[model samples]
Each structure stands twice: as C-alpha cells, then as structure tokens.
Target chain A: MNRLVLQAQILELTAIRYTPAGLPALDLVLKHESQVDEAGAHRKVALEIKAVAIGDVVRRVQALGLAGCSVFTGFLSAQKQGRGTVFHITGLES
Target chain B: MNRLVLQAQILELTAIRYTPAGLPALDLVLKHESQVDEAGAHRKVALEIKAVAIGDVVRRVQALGLAGCSVFTGFLSAQKQGRGTVFHITGLES
Candidate 1:
C-alpha cells in the first residue's frame, strides 16, 4: 500500500497531453506548506513535489486552472533511472 | 495537511547519529514496489525514497536492523535548495 495525501497549491502546470495509451494526462508541480507533528514536536514543513493526473482527473485539474489549493490522494512511483520519483494523483478534494 | 503512508523495504541505513540539539536520528533509503490502481487501471509502482526518523523513532528503526518491510507514515518536506524532498517518518508498522 502506497498512498500520499497532501494539500498543496499548483505552483506550475504543463499542457495537457496524451499518454501512449491515448489517456489524457496533465503534469504539475505542487508546493506544500504546513506544520506537522513529528517526534513529539511540531515542525514547519514545506515541499515542492512533481505530480501528474491522468484520464478523468486531468480535465478536472485543467478546469481548476491552477488557481487554488487542493488535497490530492495519490501513489508515488519512480520515474526512471536517475530521474527521482513522481506522484500519481488519483483523487482530488478541492 | 500532508501525509504519506507507504509500505517499503529498508534498502540502506545510515549510522545512528545525533542532531545539533542532541536528538537521536537515523537516515534511510527506502524501496517501495507494488501494484496500484490509477485511472481505472492497475499499474506497477516502484520508488526509492530518502527518509529520516528522529528521537524515539530512531531507536526503533535501528533495532529493526535494516531487514524486512514496514509501513511508514510520514510527511514530505524539501531538503535544501535543489536537493529534492525528504520523507520525515513519524510512525512505523512492521
């Protein structure tokens, strides 16, 4: 089980494109900032993550127009050799 | 809100260390592999992530001896500029 739930603003967006399978896809860069409890202490945390939405989720994200924050639930996967990881968003809660 | 729950194997472990504040800390590289549902299809996912555990959590991770898989619950935070993101694990389930 691999899941990531995050509330982040759309920092940047790439044009909607199609996968080799012809599925609509949208790529995004997300900025997340919040205070988190860790090791019995609260720490300020910030992250910039690479994420993508495919199929139906792509259109919803495009409609949102990168204007606001949304909570995204997704799975993480490695992109390719030496490319780091990417978040694959499956659900969105605005 | 930002949270990530992932089941991964401990791929590599760093020597137990202490923070400047004297809190025990441990660094790890985690490898995650699984089949995930996304966009109405099952896709194979694999990731190698950098993670850290501090304070009490550090001891527990060290005792586990870098063997087997565990489910880790954490938050993502960016490292220094251009260094990518790190996972701050707060809870572990063996």
Candidate 2:
C-alpha cells in the first residue's frame, strides 16, 4: 500500500502534452505547507514537489487552474531516468 | 492535510545521531514496490526515498531492523539544504 494525500497549491504548470500512447498528461509543481505534531512537538512543514497528472485527472486539474489549493491523492514513483521522485496524481479534491 | 502511507523495506541506514537540541535522529532509505490502478490501467510502482526518524520513532525503527518491510506513516518535506524531498517518518507499523 503506497499512497500520499496532500493539500497543496499548484505552484507551476506546463502545457498539456500527449504520451506516446496518446494519453493526455500535465506536469506541475505543488507547494505544501502545514503545521504538524511530531515527536510530541508542533513543527512547521513545507515543501514543493514535482507532480504529474495523466488522463482524466489532467482535465480536472486544468479546470481547477492554479488559483487555489486542492487535496491530491496519489502515489510516488522514481523518475523514468533520474535520481529523484515524482508524485503520480490519480485523484483530486478541490 | 499532508500525509503519506507507504509499505517499504529499509534499503539503507545511517548511524543514529543527535540534533543540536539533543534529540535522537536516524536517517535511512526506504524502497517501496506495489501494483496500482492509475488512469484506468494497472501500473507497477516502485521508489527509493530518503527518510528520517526522530525522537521515539527512531528507537522503534532501529529495533525493527532491516530484515522485513513495515508500513510507514509520514509527511514529505524539502531537503534541509538540497533540491530533493525527504520523508519525515512519524509512525511505523511492523
């Protein structure tokens, strides 16, 4: 079971592109900030992560635009040919 | 509203250390592999992520050792001095 639920703002977006299989895809960066309790102490946490939305989720994300924050449900995967991770978005709650 | 739940194997581990505030900390890498449904297709997902366990969680992780997999509950954070992300582990289920 691998899942990540994040409430984040769309920080940056790229133009829609088509995969080799002809599926619609969008790439974006997500900024997340929240106060969390860890080790019995409250701490401020923030981050910006690269994410990708494919197929149906891409249209919803485009409609939502980048004006507000949304909750994204997804899983993490290593880049196809890189040393970092990317969030593969499957669902969105705006 | 940021949370990540992943079942992963401990791929690498560093020696336990202490923060300036004297809190115990441990750094490690986790490898996750699963088959997920995405955009109407069954996809294989795998990733190796850098993670940290602090305070009470550190001891528990050490006790669990690296022989088996565990479910980790955590949040993602930007690296303190880098361009990548790190998983800040808050809880572990063996």
- In the order shown, what is each candidate's alpha-carbon RMSD? 1.3, 1.2
Clashing pairs in 1: none
Which stretches of candidate 2 lie above 4 Å from their native place?
none
Maximum-lDDT candidate: 2
Chain A TM-score, cand. 1: 0.93
Query: Fnat per model, in the order given?
Result: 0.82, 0.81
Q: How many Å off is the CA of A60 in candidate 1?
A: 1.5
The i-RMS of candidate 2 is 0.7
Predicted structure 1, TM vs. truth: 0.95
Distance from true position, residue A4, model 2, in Å? Answer: 0.4
DockQ values per model: 0.82, 0.86
